[model samples]
Target: MDSEKRNQNYNTYVEAKVPKTKFWQALLKAFVVGGLICCVGQLFYDLYAYWFPTLSEAQLGSAMLSTIIAITAILTGLGIFDWIGAFAGAGSVIPITGFANSIVSPSMEFKKEGIIFGICVKMFSIAGPVIVCGVVGSVLAGLIYLII
Candidate 1:
């Protein structure tokens, strides 16, 4: 009975300390940030298309994605991306930039440990599972299509 009371008290304390979520505000922020990221990608795509008029659509897309990833990596290194992520929540997390940030962040955090174990290894810690799942899913989808 004493342990039960202590547990109940702890639960109440934790509940009181938790911040309240503002659902609509979060949704709006996410929508705006995500939309802005997509707009930036589109702008890059347009610029690339204009600069390399002879390039195919796939090439233009690849260039645009590369630009976004580079920008995201730079921003993550500078520590600006974390601030944006904190303020925007999932707003900053649903885009390709977020994936870039995930890869860069762990590497930056662990860089002091050394290049091989720290930067190179930790760089993929968050992204490794995601990459694996993406590859597996794609292969499965391709196999299903072939079967069908």
Candidate 2:
């Protein structure tokens, strides 16, 4: 029952087996993943254009972003999006949908723990700095371009 005795029963000498990683596996994952994500966006774009015949191409693109964000957030709320996320992996993580997923996923997960500390902290865990740095980087790049 002692701590030392409990520790002695642990499998300390067990070897860790690494899964076979291959370049082709990764390349295939990226191709299928990236294509699927883009394909879904395309489908949504087409649907929006079909439903709203008056929308311009630019307007359709904006609507697609809004629709993706809304659907991703709703799915996050219902816990269905995570399943799609698991299969899609990087596939579901390249567009505004990914942004919505990133934000909504953490908030939903953390909400079970508590509101303030759990939800708020985890909400900005990954995407916040990315968003911040992206804006700052764009501004810097724009300035440099203007200067030269």
RMSD of every candidate to native, in Å, equals 2.4, 6.3
lDDT of 2: 0.80
The superposed Cα distance between candidate 1 and the true structure at residue 78, in angstroms, equals 1.1
lDDT of 1 at 11: 100
What value does the lDDT take at residue 64 in candidate 2? Answer: 84
On TM-score, the leading prediction is 1
Q: How high is each candidate's TM-score?
A: 0.86, 0.72
lDDT of 2 by residue, 66-86 (tens): 877897899888888778766
Candidate 2 positional error at 70, Å: 2.0
Q: Which residue runs of candidate 1 sit more than 4 Å off their true CA positions?
A: 1-18
For model 1, the local distance difference test gives 0.92
Error of 2 at 100 (Å): 1.5
Candidate 1 residue lDDT tens string, 1-148: 6999999999999999999999999899889988898899999999988888999999998999999999999999898999889878888888888899999999989999999999998998998998999999999999999999
The top-ranked prediction according to lDDT is 1
Q: How displaced is residue 71 in candidate 1, in Å?
A: 0.6
